[model samples]
Target: MLGPAERAWCVVVPHQPRGARMARHRLSTELVGTIRPGLLADVVAVLAELVGNSVRHAAPLPGEVIRVAWRHRLDGDHDIVQVRVTDGGGGAVPRLRPTDLDSLDGRGLHIVAALATRWGSDRDGLGQSVWAEFRAPAARLPGPDGDDPAPNDLLATR
Candidate 1:
């Protein structure tokens, strides 16, 4: 179990067709509950780009699956939300190119870096997971306790 200081939440999207569909289906539903409206918008946008990148670049073969996961955390005083999109693709680390300004296709990563607090990638036996983190609003509160009398109660806001 994670300490209260750790604000991150981890979600796993398996590497299968059903997993991919499930991932998409859960995006709005899950995030709507976990994230604030404004911050949620940013997170979802970044997620779309990263997930699309995985679909286009990752996936081991013609019909392989991609895995995606995300977690929210607090690093120091900053509240952070991190997302990881994993796929079987083993391409080079994505980069932002000057020419990307003129092209419509390659700006995804650039937009991610601009909007996210930090972003990177990792490759292990499980394949690759590209990650991005964004700072939530300072006024935002931590999530509710499971046993709260009022289900709408948020820890930090209290």
Candidate 2:
């Protein structure tokens, strides 16, 4: 859910495969800065794939924008991070059907499907946002002797 004033943030993505310097930005950093590196990588991979799909498929109109946003929630004891990538193209339907192995395209959504715990789309006849959610890793406990361990060492054993 985004307010009208905040919608400008959605205009940064390039609608078509070709463009003149399409821009991109991340609207959420709360979990981005807090999640484990490995888990964060997963989130980023999906986000990139979704954004790339928008740029490749969504035909951009003149002076249009593509925006991205994210929100976090708790699913049972696990953390759920939801990411959305939106563009100004018409609500073009996207499918994840199988393609030739030699084709380089059509794999983006497939990757999202395999990685996201859940995913969907939201359309307003103008454009849509492809959203995906991932379960966060278990919370790390403080180290012995009342010290905070390095992020890289949180699950590593010496």
Best by lDDT: 1
Q: Pick the candidate with the highest TM-score.
A: 1
Task: Give one digit per residue, the lDDT tens place, for model 1 in 101-128.
Answer: 4676878888899888899888777777
Off by over 4 Å in 1: 5-25, 61-63, 74-78, 138-158
Please provide, for model 2 over 5-121, each residue's C-alpha lDDT reduced to its tens digit, 9 standing for 90 to 100: 112123355454332123222533434445556666677778777777777667543465566666554344455667787776545576687878899777888888888998888
Candidate 2 residues lying further than 4 Å off, grouped into runs, are 1-33, 141-158
TM-scores of the candidates in the order shown:
0.70, 0.67
For candidate 2, the 10 contiguous residues with the lowest summed lDDT are 2-11
lDDT of 2: 0.61
Model 1: per-residue Cα lDDT at residue 101: 48
How many times do residue backbones clash in model 2? 5
RMSD in Å for all candidates: 5.2, 7.5
